[model samples]
Target: MTMVLCIGHPERSPVLPLHPGARYYAAPSPVGTPGGDGTRGRPWDLATALAGGRGGSMVQPGDTIWLLGGVYPGRFDGTLTGTSAAPIVVRQYPGERATIDGNLHVHGAHTVYWGFEITQSNPVPNANDALETYGPDCKFINLVVHDAGKQGMSFWEDEGTSELYGSIFYNNGTHENFDHGVYAASEGGEKWIVDNIVFDNLAYGIHVYVGSRHPFLSNVHVRGNTAFNTGAISRDGFQNANLLIGGDVRTEHMSADSNLLYFPGTTGRNLRLGMPRGDNRDILVRGNYVAGGAVTLLMNGWAQAEVVDNEFIGAGTIVDLTARGGSIVAHAWHGNTYVRDPGARAWRYEGAAYELATWQKITGLGNTGATGTTPMTPRVFVRPNKYEPGRATIIVYNWGHQPTVSADVSSAIHAGTRYELRNVQALLGPPVLSGTYGGGAIEIPMAGVDPPRPVGRTGPTPALARTGPVFDVFILNRTK
Candidate 1:
């Protein structure tokens, strides 16, 4: 009975399209000379406005380079190339704050960096990276990469599509030689990585490798982001992990939603998904919110994954699949929610350990049920319907612990259009309303009853309605 559909009024990001041209300026103690002539009151030093010299003065394609506010040492490589609709921005100079103490490569393609701050402390043992791209449709916004002796931002064997929004990778591997805090690998394009904020890294905090002979990392997405205490300093005990998706190549259309993982004393492994020389099909692990971790999700060998609605708090062994071997196709672990620490054993197949009801009866695999704490589910909230233009205002919330007795709602309008059901309220129980409305569907049958539970209520509570479960449906549309 989990039917959540919140449509209209919330998706907005998409308005990048600019092409104006020339405007350069750089200063790390400017005021002319260092091969000045980058105009904007003659500015230029920051490696001569990114090495645009040798008698040609580069940085073309819809230009714009303004890095003005202090500290800007060594390495800036760039090469320039802008063209996915004329990009090549490189910002930071209005309310200033442009610190870049070293490292930043990018080999040339639609660039657009905005709001910088990469601090490569003493790097250079192995060319310590703190931002190294091979170029493609680049777009980093609000970046803040930190102290690195290795990785903090890398897209290495590049190809095309790339974007990392609202970034902030912290503490990065100093001499222990960084492993990742954002590292996308070879082959082709596609990667969005939204809202970012990876923490103390010394190994994986978002690493997507695809080696075993490249090709097949298709369309990655990773949403909302907020990883914590990543691998600390792994000397390779299987490279920790906060979000690692190794590779024998092939990982079509990936997705990691709602992210927010943690790993306190750090032993890492908040989400690992390796094994894909061929079938890792459409992978998706939704609504994440994992905690602490000894192993939050390690589905090593086989993959066709789709773990939904996550919330595995205080993990010690949430799901370990003993290196997975044979007969497990089309995997799915729905609604997820295991609180842990009473004896800690959620799962560990094949080598034996199962807990969530004997691991959902020998792996037909967790069907939406497991909770020792953190399970309130059932929350839908739609809007529009102020004065009716197509009207809509659903709000079903049943903070459960044993309540919801019946619920089967549906949406999707305009087939013949004529739905009408105003303000039906059911604070608790006997509201008798039964389904079938409108042509495009609008079914509803929300009978209720939930309240007892003080140690004297084992099941039914028909009319003692205790004020939990809130309801309100107000749809209306009449346009034949």
Candidate 2:
């Protein structure tokens, strides 16, 4: 009940005129192979150019098919109608290498497309989500969905969907079921924007469920992609967390900034919050830079989230709020930098033992006794002095500039102490700041003991050692 079919057009190459809902079946490239005709010479057999008779066929409604370069496997039942004022385009012309297999159906104002490459190695329940858009305003550009039998790209419950920009969801590793390299079930508002490049998956590389199955998902933008080693949650199914988040009540806005999540394991939680449990407020995770893992950040069951300035290397509880029980409310933790991986597993906020005084302070220690201008800027915050042998010294001066204005002072010493230098020359005006650049004469060998208290809140403790000189305090900010 519609018409207008044209394949391969740069200027004009229309030589198969048979109107009436137009249908031209011929996609040859394999089978005795001798100059296939999809273009230049002999090119047809993408299931008889998009299904057309027993071998597997189905496609009508101004059908415009064109795929020919090489590699065209089999299986593809069709239905690509056009109604949004005429919309149904199956593509592959920029150095074509088309390939599609089984399961791909779009109806009504149909707009099922093709950019090819969906390989499955057994285990075909969801066909590893090799491409789906339940036709609303359907869209897919520069596609490459790899290794599937589970999840690589699945979208249904459409309502004006759009996915532009080169996409590539790889590995999709699944033994049974973890699948999720890119999944979106919009309820209606629709706008699942994934600037793709997901890798090594078994689960949670990009997954979003908007309750009641596709509530037209609102605008969701996951920028500059690269989610490494995705979370494979589900050894036996039931979902445990691997970046699986449910609709924030019905989508309005959800974001993930400057992507790059490395080596994540433990089923999930590189960035997971509220899944199908409903009521998820605005989500905004900023400046990503994660490494290895064991709970980098999991505010499970969210209801108001915002964890900022990220950079947590080799994680182990960078933030794992125990399920936020009791209907979690508004959460906010600023400036993240948890680089404490001393053989892992030490931080636990629930059973106690959690220390983060800005990650154990070391506020610039000083001792400028040679009048480089008296600037022994000391700001020591102490609390670890059980004295197996503890020592403290502070004295810096800048009475008004000195004999050559030399200044240098650094502190943190404890291992059986012995800097034995009754006087190594230079009473202040000889070395204006040397030790190259990391500063000079610095020695930190601590033992002073008693620095492990967080099991039951004995409180008031932090500063076992931090004796100043963070770059030999030299004032010039002028504010005397």
Candidate 3:
């Protein structure tokens, strides 16, 4: 039950919480104002600011709305609109952090939202996410979305153009496999998923699939992303792939390139093109580094494909070009490096298995391909929380069972800054260690520190393997 999207607003304005540009301030609960006047001394409540203005002062385009540093409880729906050039801006106040402990739905166009932490603060029986972008041509920058219910961000196709950039989505979704990190679709303009870190969600990490529901999905470019153990946290059987870009209908002009996909336990599936029984065109899957799994192309019509310079490391079907008995025209396939077991499923074409030599002979593709046994070496994968200057999400890939390793935080935190490190699994608990940064690496204790996994319903903490190739996630916070 969804309503048609409407992108219109009357003065269409917002003001930053930090920068200088017709700024307005809003606080919650105990820090609220009485008969407020949108001033620093007497800030309005969160609701008044979102509703355009109070009494005389109205939030206008190119304006900024500054959210005071505190938790804003309850679900909110913003209907502010802005012009194409003078879009509304909503930001956190100077050094203070703003936390929206409930759902947020933005129905305005040309809005720029920045630097906020979104999660559920209470029991949401129906279980909806805290983010939904129905507005077209908007930007979501540096959002930390975790431990929510259902989908992480419902970027509907109605949002003709939008960008999900420099964000972190993990530990989302319930036990239900229907949820996803980014449940998205597109019909007009571009839906860009760029430079993000998504992991351990219940279902697919970047699910750009609509099945037969939508007419078609197009113009989505997923680039420079790092997704691992996408569907491995909550469910078993390696529930879903790290990235998926297909539907049960028609999809065109999309690409998934320069991304890293890693799942070590079993088949660590990475990027998949075209769902079973769909049609795709002008697709590009290139420059991706995949480990433990492969770049699987399945059940669809790939009218044209450009797969180049991708490195695959695994013992199973590292590269399935035939599209699992679907229709595909792989025009350009070169510079692909395959590091697999000697006699494993390396290449399959026209419903048959073949080595590098035979695969080139029959298909005449992958002529410049090379095969070796050097897999992607395990190490720490770090992604900085770009909008929140001194914060980062790290993944410690302990391939050799190292008890502890020094994790570099110099990039996230410079010298003379105090930092706090915590295991994301035990995120609600105390920090693992806290000290001032000296432009050096932070020693992370891996194998010895096993935090019992947290769950919603009360039950025995499920047992997780802590053996070879153990991967643990951590958060580094720079104390203000």
lDDT of each: 0.61, 0.43, 0.69
TM-score of each: 0.32, 0.29, 0.81
lDDT (Cα, tens digit) per residue for candidate 2, span 198-304: 54455566777655543435556554344544532224321333344456465445666545454433333565555545655566766554444566555445556
Using TM-score as the measure, the top candidate is 3
Off by over 4 Å in 2: 1-44, 47-70, 73-77, 80-130, 135-144, 147-152, 158-180, 186-198, 201-204, 209-228, 231-242, 250-271, 275-278, 281-297, 302-315, 322-480
Expressed as tens digits, the lDDT of each residue in 261-362 for candidate 1 is 666433567887765354455568787766656777777655567778887765478777633356565777777777774355667776578667766767
Tell me model 1's lDDT, rounded to 2 decimals. 0.61
TM-score of 2: 0.29
Model 3, range 1-480, lDDT digits (tens) per residue? 111111111212222234335888888865655368778778877767766668534887788888888898878776666666677777788778788877888887877777677776442353787688788888887777776777778886365567787777776677557777778888778887866777777788888887787788888888767777666555453657888898877888998877767776445456677775777666887877776754443323477888788877665676655553344445677887777654565667666877767766776653746777653334665666654678776666565566666666766788999888977656557887888888757677775344334245232323554323366667788896
Residue 71 error for model 2, in Å? Answer: 1.2
Which candidate ranks first by lDDT, i.e. highest? 3
Which is better, 1 or 2, measured by TM-score? Answer: 1
Ranking by TM-score: 3, 1, 2
